[model samples]
Target: MLHKFQQFYPDLERLINFIAISDEYVAKAPSQERFLEVIIRLEREVFGTAKMRGPRVASLRVGEPKNLRDCYDTYKAQKRETVEQVTLELETTVRTLVTDVS
Candidate 1:
């Protein structure tokens, strides 16, 4: 998965690698809550308020596992949408440029 993303989305691949390595390190936390906290902090740093952190902050007052999962799902959905929108805009811009040149 990381390899496939490397060519077109190096930044995303790097973020995935960082998250995987971070999870491995945080896996040794003394408590599950501690592990979750560390994971959330790492995610917040990577994804920030524009993506995942906003929903996490608004909906995750309590650290329930279900809420965490929900927030993650929301983050994934929003990220996917944002990527698609950017790709579409880039394609449109390129097409317009090509048409103008022709």
Candidate 2:
């Protein structure tokens, strides 16, 4: 469990980027749905279960170029306001599609 937890954030981020890009390119909704289905299945294998929220993508530069871990640590160090805004935006978007049965 601990080992999986360590890798979860990056894995999660990848899933977010995949979903975000796929949606933005609506001309290929089939391609996006196909990829998302595959990723969802794979994630269940690796991490048991995940709940989709909004999508998040960032070009973050973590300190200590040699240390990828430092990059995530820097992500954690970012200001609270920036983080919350991004989170809320994603939630709103995701929820709209998720609840839109029309």
Candidate 3:
């Protein structure tokens, strides 16, 4: 459990950092899904869980760069939509909780 926790943040941080500077990576991808595949693989490697691949396509690979840009629209629209929906839900839940507390 401790090992899992320790690995989680760094890996997730790497994912965010990779996404931030991923223009070069995404540009090199043969397809958007292929790029996301790279991300999924990284997540598994860092987190040691196929579950991290989540609902995203399970096209894991090694030594490929990926990005969030075309992972939607040209890639997988549902992934973006899912993220947006989750963001909205979290925001709404937080707002409601704050309002009730006050």
Which order, best to worst by lDDT?
A: 3, 2, 1
Clashing pairs in 2: 62-71
Backbone clash total, candidate 2: 1
| Highest-scoring model, lDDT | 3
Per-residue lDDT of candidate 1, residues 16-41 (tens digit) = 65566554565565675565566565
Error of 3 at 51 (Å): 45
Q: Relative to the true structure, how large is the alpha-carbon lDDT of every model? A: 0.56, 0.58, 0.60
Model 2 misplaced stretches (Cα beyond 4 Å): 1-78
Q: Candidate 2 overall Cα lDDT vs. reference?
A: 0.58
Best by TM-score: 2
Off by over 4 Å in 3: 1-77
lDDT of 2 by residue, 13-98 (tens): 76765565444454555565566565565566567665575773423232222333534655577757555755676677666655
Q: Name the better of 1 and 3 by lDDT.
A: 3
Return whichever of 2 and 3 wins on lDDT: 3
Better candidate number, 2 or 3, judged by TM-score: 2
- Model 3, span 64-91: residue lDDT tens: 2335464456336477676776567667
